[model samples]
Target: MSLFLIAGIALTGFLAAGLGTMVGLGGGVFVVPILAVVLGVELKAAIAASAVCVVLNSLRGSSVYLQRGLVNVKLAMVLQVSTAVAAIVGGLIVIFAPVQILKLLFAATLALTIGVMIARPNGGKRVKSGPDPYGLRASFDRPDDRGPAEYVPQHVRSGIGLSSVAGLTSGMLGIGGGAVQVPIMNTVMAVPLRAAVATSTFMVGITATVSALIYAGAGLVDVAVTVPAMAGIVVGAQMGGQLGSHVPVKMLRTLLIAVLLGLTIAMAADGLGFL
Candidate 1:
């Protein structure tokens, strides 16, 4: 039974990684829920594995985007420092919170994701997609064969705010928050939508790693859940990232909203002892 459960988890990890890479988001949203459902993992344990898998998926997904010249490293570096610091604090918060309460909060956030998705429309937007917005400009070639790319900022402070929020969310939840950060960069910060999406992939590892170590230290992580899940997630992210350039990113974003909402309700159920 353990072997069968392990295999099932491995498969789910693959699916999560694929979906995450396709959307330029980390796979934690996918990994965490599956661990809860199939593996009967406690929310805390699932969150730990989610953090680890997100880091692994980010390593694979971001590496590909970087190689293709889609990642904006300067932006990643600047945001990562603050995001990482915040993440450690955030992870500690999770450790101390009542497990039932944490579950409820996670559920609420899932509902928020749905609202964000429906409210925002992604298409043509011009914004700064950089970590250093204080007179720094970043230009890169598009990986998906769009063409050359360049971004100018209209709202730098807003971008920083969003990235900071991403950091907070990443720590509060066991997930990378590229979905939230990417859109804010594209829409509010006036970053080119495509560029923001591509570059957002790089932030996952930095954010997840910050919290994962704390979880590991707290003895909240279960290797039975983390090890195999991360292995599959890394491999799946690579494969999905290769396919990413082909799919419609907007569609994936829409799908991601529904998926996040469904998972949220399920998580709430788990909290209420329904699961």
Candidate 2:
């Protein structure tokens, strides 16, 4: 592409990475839409590029969260197992399944999630004061808190089940699964939103790495497009990570809800051939 086009793509990556890291969406959600719709790139190529950006964005963002003790490594590892396996299943299903139908289903799922989240906006931050059976409990200091907040991850089996679905969608859609993972971790699993976001940041890196490899193997990755975008994502992720560490939890929650709403609309439109 031309230098001007390269510059524009890098700028897009910067903005996407910043927001994605802040809300734990791994940047793929924004990058895919911008690349495919606004920039007029082919859909598969855009997804491939987005997968690469998310990998780098998550890695960089996770490092910051880890340093601040916000990431729940144990919980992330446990969920990764399910997501990783389901991604392969999703890849295989693409051969026989109609993508439009899948999109509609995914959109419906997001809509339902949004309703649940709105109805129970404060449900995920509860800290259980008893023994933890799953050993997935963790604690972290919030930006606005006077002390650390402790929370045990509940409903792990259910979280695993949902994560598998997230991974399947990730594979089928060629995007990182962080959007679904964040809500499931926070809402269904009773993880604190900050920790859930941090953990999701870490988790998406591994999942995106797997996805990027698949795209690379398929010759869908465009190095020329990826290099510039990755450079921007790297810097933006650092900025986002720093901001995330200090941002108020209420603002973060609001932003996450808005993002889900937007994604719901986008997926529904795509399913209906309106986008």
Candidate 3:
């Protein structure tokens, strides 16, 4: 590609990653569509490039969340096991799945994500007193200095089931799995939205790492496309992590819903051969 074209791609990657990180979607939601539809890249190639960006965004974003003590390490670790295994299966399926079908799946997933965000726009604020019997306790300091908050995760089994689905989508679509994970963690598991985002960021790195390896081994990844995109994603993820820490939960939810709605429309159009 020409220097100017490369620069434009990098800029797009930066914007995608920034938005994805802020909303905990990991940028693949934007990156894959732009690459495949706008840039005219092949679907598999676009997915591989998006997977690399997802990994970079997750690493940078998760580190920031960890430092703030927003991540639930134990819960993340438990969830990663399911996500990682399912991601490998998803990667294998993508090798043979039709591009049109994948596009439809992406659209459907985004639509579901929008519904989940709308249903639970606010992070659940009611905290049960006393220690959790399941030992899924997590604590984080509030941005407004209202003192630290603590909550126990409920519905562990359901969370794991959702994580597996998230992993499959992440591997097949090159998303970070946060779109599914964050809502489930917040709405079903009773974790706060920020905490859910943080935990999802951490787990998605592991999920994407497994899928990226599969794509790399199959020679699906285009290094020329992935490298610059990753460079931009790293910077954007840092900026997003910082910004997310300060933004209100309601605003973040609104941003996520809006983005998902837009992506849903684009993916559906593309799947129906209208784009």
Candidate 4:
């Protein structure tokens, strides 16, 4: 590829990672579609490159959240187990799955994420004095004047079940599983949104790491594409992690929904050969 094209790809990675880090979707969601659709790269190659960048985005994003005490390490660790196992299955499937199927799955998942985000518009509600439900308690400083937010994760079993699905998609689609995890954590588990996002960021790094290794082992990863994207994501994720702490929760949710909606349409079209 020309240096100019490489620069453009890096810029795309930068924007994708920044938004993904801020919203906990993982940068691969944007990177995969952009590469496959706009840049006309093959679908599998795009997915492989996205898997690589997502690992960097999650690692860099998680560090900031960890420092700010937004991450629930225990929660993230518990979730990672199921995700890791599922990722292996997903990775194996990716080698044989049809390109059209993968593209449709990506669009379907994005639509699901949008529906979940809209269903539970309110988040970051303060916890009331009560008995421990699931024994996974998390707390973080509120970005608003609502004081510190504390909440116990309500449904451990459900979170694990849903997170496995997230991991499977992460491996197959190279989106890092955060798009699914955030909604499951915030809405289903009752963890605060900010905490959910942080935990998702931390969890995705592990999930993506497994997926990346699988893709690399299969020789699906393209260095010419992955190198620029990874470099951009490493920097953009740090910027996003800092910015996320200050941005309004409502604005973040809105942006996520809007972006997903557009991507859903584009990817679905691309999958059907309409793009």
TM-score, every prediction:
0.84, 0.77, 0.86, 0.84
Q: Candidate 2 lDDT, tens digit per residue, 187-221?
A: 88888887888898788778777767776776878
Write down the RMSD of all candidates, one decimal each: 3.4, 4.1, 3.0, 3.3
Per-residue lDDT of candidate 1, residues 1-275 (tens digit): 39888887788788888887786556776777767755676778889888887777677667767777766677667657777877887798889988877777777766766666677766445544545436546677765777677876556655665677777778877888876777776777666665676667678788888889999999998898788788778778878878999988888887887778778888899878887
Residue 261 in candidate 1, Cα distance off native in Å: 3.7
lDDT per model, in order? 0.75, 0.74, 0.81, 0.82
Evaluated at residue 33, the lDDT of candidate 1 is 70
Worst 10 residues of 2 by lDDT: 90-99
Per-residue lDDT of model 4, residues 1-275, tens digit only = 88987887788788887876676556787888777777777888888888877777677667878999999998888888999999988988888888888889889987877887687555535454467755567677777868877777776788888899999999899887776888788777778777888899888889988988999999999898889888877777768867988988689779778977988998898888897
Minimum summed lDDT over a 10-residue window in model 4 is located at 120-129
Q: Cα deviation of 16 in candidate 3 (Å)? A: 1.4
Q: Alpha carbon lDDT of residue 266, candidate 4?
A: 88
Worst 10 residues of 3 by lDDT: 117-126
TM-score head-to-head 2 vs 4, winner:
4
Identify the superior model by lDDT, candidate 1 or candidate 2: 1
What is the clash count for each candidate, in the order shown? Answer: 6, 0, 0, 0
**Which lDDT tens digits does candidate 3 get at residues 1-275?**
67775676677688787776665556777777777777777888888988888887777777788999999999998778898999999998778788899889888877876776566566555475665766778789999999988888887888888889999999998888787888778877888888898899888888999999999999999887888778777777778767877878577778767766887888889999998
Pairs with backbone N, CA or C atoms under 3 Å apart (clashes), candidate 1: 75-131, 126-190, 127-190, 127-191, 128-190, 128-191
Off by over 4 Å in 3: 22-24, 117-134, 239-263
